[model samples]
Target: MSAAARAVVDTAALRHNLLSVREAAPGSRVMAVIKANAYGHGLVEVARALADADAFAVARLDEAVALRDAGLAHRIVLLEGVLRSEELSRAAALRLEPVIHCPEQVSALEQASLDNPLRAWLKIDTGMHRLGFPPGEAVGVARRLMASGALAKPPVCMTHLACADEPEETVTRSQLAAFAGAVADLPGDRSAANSAAILAYPESHMDWVRPGIMLYGVSPFEGRCGADLGLRPVMSLSSPLIAVKDVPAGGRVGYGGTWTADRATRIGIAAIGYGDGYPRCLGSTDTPVLLGGRKAQLVGRVSMDMIAIDLTDAGDAAVGDEVTLWGADLPVEILASRAGTIGYELLCGVTQRVAVSYV
Candidate 1:
């Protein structure tokens, strides 16, 4: 272990989560979402770990190139598709499958003359206003792509779920219905479910299921955790307590003297803070960190390189003791709630300053 903060990744847990995804959507092919540096868990490392996945999905072309550059031969799908003619040609050379969401991407495909045709996914905007063509234009767009002759086969039909995590909401059902109606006559396979839909809406798991947060063992739904869904957390953020000292009553801690000791007690300084992507908002809150397997409340303002944890409840605490910010024992979802954010943001917010070690 290094003196600074470190994020330990459990490869076994990642593999387990992939298996869980397979169990949840048994009939659907798994398109593992490894975009955004695999949610800040190391891109290539995760791709290597889940090599058995049917395919991988990324937001940009560079991520796919990175995977290919790593010597990985797995099928890579570009979620955003290509923007220019050169990109379309390059994607074809890489044997990438780009999601044709808009007419611009389709035009790029139509104008390009590649040595080998590309396999693509056609995205329809059922409700999510972010990407994809309008639902009414689905058939016309499909016809255009088929006429372009740039595709090796008919494009897979897909859509993004806006609110699959909210089970009580009717939006997901409406979106699913819209997707089915739009692609009912279209050729090729279909995909609609993200991590939440994979767990909650079984009907949405048509031909392919794109699993993102669940692959990292983080829950997409509120009021639940990964363990509750039978998923194991893969990342454990920890740091060693650099200093241990006692503060007298009326003494202040950290910057701006925000926290005052009501009585004399011990405080331990951990070498992790916002600089390492540990939420600074956690400071001066009731959020707890595990110190030697015991809970220790955070106190005062979080500094750039350090945070002070009240060790009054932590028995036999000392310098060099391990302080876990979040992991299998303390779910990141709880800490994210305390920090006024979600687990996805917290996980992806982990900066490059901290070293990552895979088990």
Candidate 2:
């Protein structure tokens, strides 16, 4: 049976992107970030494909549990750390590492009594004020964890780069400096680089590099595609032209009548929309999709389960012809730009209904 919409994941491209990460940061160990179900590329599936990763990092404990349940023995780091004391035991039992980002988490580790201590990471908030301990408090927090004996070893000191994607920005340099100064005296491996830093800031790739978007072969920077960084795209979103017809010059298309046919126009209705994670905000004539390998414009407001494509140029396009939403040929970044979002959201936004096939 043919799926209405499908996302094709290329395992080889994923491995190839991993190689790209290695080539960019040859000296650093990779902690592949597979959070958000491997950025919607299927969690356990991507892990199995990139089994060579030094460790895997996810945003939540359940994600780590999913990986563990899948029989993946790779070291998994919970980026958000455990929320409560009870989760600590499960995290410990699963042999999962949690990022000690706050005083409460530190307190939890201090009070918990576990048979086996957990190997953990200490996140210092250099500039990205979202998580982690403040710079001055980082050393103190590490000491507290060490004094508690909850950690199997010295915690791996780490921080996130807020502006690493913007190479010309001074914030990245300041954040790097702050992180270095904060953890200089700490006795453990240090990590700071994300996908953007791995490719641009070699100095920040201290001990571990967390490649998230790049692992799925998407660029972390604006105005750049993964191909520019020697990475192959892993996911190709495609659907079939399920219906085709001609509309009169004065006729309006789709909901709200936002688009009107200026001339006799041929339209193709593709089986993809916001319901399938295709951006509804992308209902514009400027938005492009490939119909039978020819360029076509998206017209009118996107419906729940379909998008109308102006097939004026691709008059030869017929029902059942493949229409590519985004892929190696049409970068998701382009579509994301049209939708006023980033490639990351588009990749992660793919819904459950869309069938995923691995190559």
Candidate 3:
């Protein structure tokens, strides 16, 4: 209880989610995606929790190196791969599997005289233009990389899904087709499914499945929640109600007087706000919080260090009552929708100002 605001991470729930991923993609090797500081759940903490995963995936070389430095021997793949000579050298030295997306990365690898050869993934731009070579050019790029002798083994073929979360399977099907066509003659294992693809599109689950947000017990689809997907929430953000006061009818609350009481109401000021990564955009009265185990709506603007929730219905609410902003009972996905964002942003946005305790 270092801070009034604390994010309790359930390690058991995290392991359970990983097991769920295994059940969904039993045939494919699980490349647990723990990038972006494990989506703000502490990178090292998440890696240690998912140690049973076949391998781990990060977006940068430093993240991979950090795991190695921590003394864990799990295979790590750098999703974005290396860009410069130094990064290439460091990645190779760390035995990191870099996903070579662009020709510049391949050029760097070919030119660098590393201490050891590196195994890598060749990313093809099936539909997502963010990274990788186009389908027309991927095979040639793979062939050239193999001939360079910088790689320890043949590169694994991989691609990103642009619309795996959408119910319309047209885009995912097309991307899968393009990926298959691009690497049809190539000699290597293939990976394509992300979190959404793992649950929705079974055919996309190839040799490897990189489960990201799903591992954190958050659903990628819009209408569904983590529970709907049989995933248990890992992070439960809670704060204490520092103050409880009575506001008469027409009394305004919070910054800008945004919310006015329609009748005499009880208000509870929670010790959490945008400063602690609770989105300031969550300003609607429909947004609810768990106050003393009862539903309470958020009213007025969210401040940097506090938020006012309408505790009128919870007459028994008192000062120092535990407030659940989002957790097992209160879904972050719903909270995200009220804030005009997604669950990923909410989970990742939790700032360093707040203390995180693993349970």
Candidate 4:
């Protein structure tokens, strides 16, 4: 581990979170999305953690290859279909399922003749309108893939729900209606729910639930926390107190001199900063770290390698005492809310400058 900052990933906690996903969607297959290096928890690590995951989903073909190279045997789905005609062969060779969202993807699949044709998902453009065949065009596109024998089996009908997080909203139901109508009488499974739907909209959990942030132990609901959903945080962004000193009343510390002591105070220098993915903006008028398990206010602007925290009542905290940026006792949602962002951003933003130690 690096001397200044450390990120510890708990494999046990990861397993617990996957179990929670299954518990929430007891009947549906769990297609755990491990893209963006498993939301910055390290791709291979998170994939290994969810060993029993029904399948894995990545944004591209290269990510699917990475898992296969790592000896991961779970079915892999490429959320974005092949980028070119050549990739279709590689994808089929790897037994990777591509979500053919656009007409071009269907064209690429049609061009390829694999000994083992690929099993693919047909993405329908619902209200999100991000990718995929328009809902009205879904059936025709699917029929072409089916008749051509480019696909090994019927395409899995899928659509993204824009408002599944808002439980009372009717948008998801409408999207499901449109998606179901297009794939009607199509003898294949359907996948619609994301992490939010797996937890909040059980009806949307048709055949598979694609969970992203939830696998990293983050809640989809605004007021709720991951812990409340029986999820455990997989990463602990921790650092040690490098130094501590006394500052006279009205004295300022660190860059910009933004925080001036109102009374005689004890100041602590934490050895990780924005360079290590700790939010620099959080230094002023935002959440800080916990010291000796007591809340401490951050002081001044964060430096490239250090941040100062006003620790007046931190109470005899030593130079090497552990400081939690977020994990365990300090919920990431708490820090994210105070930073005017979300946990997903903060978690994925953890930079490579920090050392990562797996547990």
All models, RMSD in angstroms: 0.9, 1.0, 1.1, 1.5
User: What TM-score do all the candidates reach, one by one?
Assistant: 0.99, 0.98, 0.98, 0.96
The number of clashing residue pairs in each candidate reads 0, 0, 0, 0
- Tens-digit lDDT track for model 1 on 1-359? 56699999999999999999999999999999999999999999999999989999999999999999999999999999988888988999999999999888888888889888999999999998999998899999999998999999999999999999986769998999899889988988999999999999999999999999999999999889999999999999999999999999999999999999999979999999999999888985798899888888999999989999999999988888899999999999999889888999999999999999999
Report the Cα lDDT for residue 275, model 2.
Answer: 99
Q: Which runs in model 2 stand beyond 4 Å of their true positions?
A: 1-3
**For model 1, what is the alpha-carbon lDDT of residue 216?**
96
- Model 1, residue 89: C-alpha shift (Å): 1.2
Question: Stretches of candidate 3 above 4 Å error?
Answer: 1-3
Predicted candidate 3 versus true structure: per-residue lDDT over 1-359, tens digit per residue: 33379998999999999999999988999999999889989899989999999999999888898899998788899999988988888888878899999988889887888889889999999988899999999878988888888898899999999999998989899999999999999997999999999999999999999999999999999968999999999999989989899999999999899899999998989899999999888875479899767888889999999999888787788888889999999999999888888899999999998888898
Give the per-residue lDDT digits (tens) of candidate 2, residues 1-359.
37399999999999999999998899999999999999999999999999999999999999999999999999999999996878999999999999999888988899999888999999999999999999999888888999998889999999999999886869999999999899989998999999999988889998899999998888899999989888899999999989999999988999999999999999899999899999888886389899777888899988889999989898688889988999999999888888888999999999999999999
lDDT of 1 at 345: 93
Best by lDDT: 1
Kindly list the per-residue Cα lDDT of model 4 for residues 64-174, writing each as its tens digit: 999999999899999988857668888888899999998777777777777788899989988888988888888788899998787888999899988888857778888
Ten residues in sequence with the least summed lDDT for candidate 2: 284-293
Ranking of all candidate structures by their lDDT, best first = 1, 2, 3, 4
lDDT of 3 at 23: 96
Q: After superposition, how far is residue 45 of candidate 2 from its true place, in Å?
A: 0.4
